[model samples]
Target: MAETEESTGPPATLIDPIEMSKLDTKFREEIHSMPNGEELSACFACSTCTAACPIANIWKYKPHQLIRMILLGMRDEVLSSDEIWLCLTCFQCQERCPQKVRVTDIFFDCKNLAAEEGKVPPNIVGLGKELLEKGQLYTVTADWEREDMGLEPDVPGLSVDGLRNILKETRTSKLVDGDK
Candidate 1:
């Protein structure tokens, strides 16, 4: 007797039916009006963006799936989704999209909207705080990193104090401080 071979892939997921009442009908239009979001309608659900994404395998919803969700006006789900925060802003998906949908930029627009609503992840907010306070994301502990690149050991005196002062008056500082 021949035994059936076990499938190596993850189990199939059961998709829940979308409720018409929950969908924000104007959501797609809102995204469409944003810069670089106008071409969202061009996506034909080819999954090319998903194929081009380096981290697609780990995504809760792949690139094409996100576009479909936007087109379907899944406002609450899309806005509250942790998936948007997971994006790396790499242009591979955008570059490979036959529709030229500017996938990365569109995601950025979604991120902005989410940020406006204070849906940002804590890690990102912490990074923003670091940037606002230090004027640089990475620590400048040693000069070897610069020396390895054939550059001067010390970063020339451009006062981060002035930068922090100026940034305190900007929107970024408020976002970092959770002011809005």
Candidate 2:
């Protein structure tokens, strides 16, 4: 018996289809446990969701690809991908999905899973740390832009005590230092 390039089947000694259902089952677990797992099984691989996604144009794998990967159980690649974090959470894909797949929600789930698994990229980690420290997701806009827009230099109706209480109740106080 000789193995040829044209051999389309596994070797006779290989007793199990090691790359089959087991992989699907395992990855399916990750997908189902994701934030909106209900939609994970419904994807039909249509590119409509991807086509409607603003961020998909810039992504290495569009929304549908990410969903397909989850369906196929490609956990490591999905978890480590920058595409997961790059999602803007705009929900455009969700709205356009003919299957009603919760595309945006699933991306959120993947991001959470990646964070839980400590697989977040360094840039995201640093940004999260900064948000936690500053209690703001982004730095203040340029002073000139604010002045040009005639906006008040200070935030409206926000006080340190009010913000502290809200953050504490939301379990995000840990992101700030010297807050009780």
List TM-scores for all candidates, in order.
0.82, 0.72
How far does residue 177 in candidate 1 sit from its true spot (Å)?
A: 2.0
> Model 1 over residues 109-152: C-alpha lDDT tens digits?
89889889888888888888888878778756647778888877
Single out the weakest 10-residue window by summed lDDT for candidate 1. Answer: 1-10
Clashes of each: 0, 1
Report how far off residue 110 is in candidate 1 (Å). 0.3
Least accurate stretch of 10 residues (summed lDDT) in model 2?
Answer: 171-180
lDDT of 1 at 6: 66
Model 1 Cα displacement at 31 (Å)? 0.4
lDDT of 2 by residue, 99-125 (tens): 888888888888877766667676665
Clashing residue pairs for model 1: none
Q: Candidate 1: misplaced stretches above 4 Å? A: 1-16, 143-153
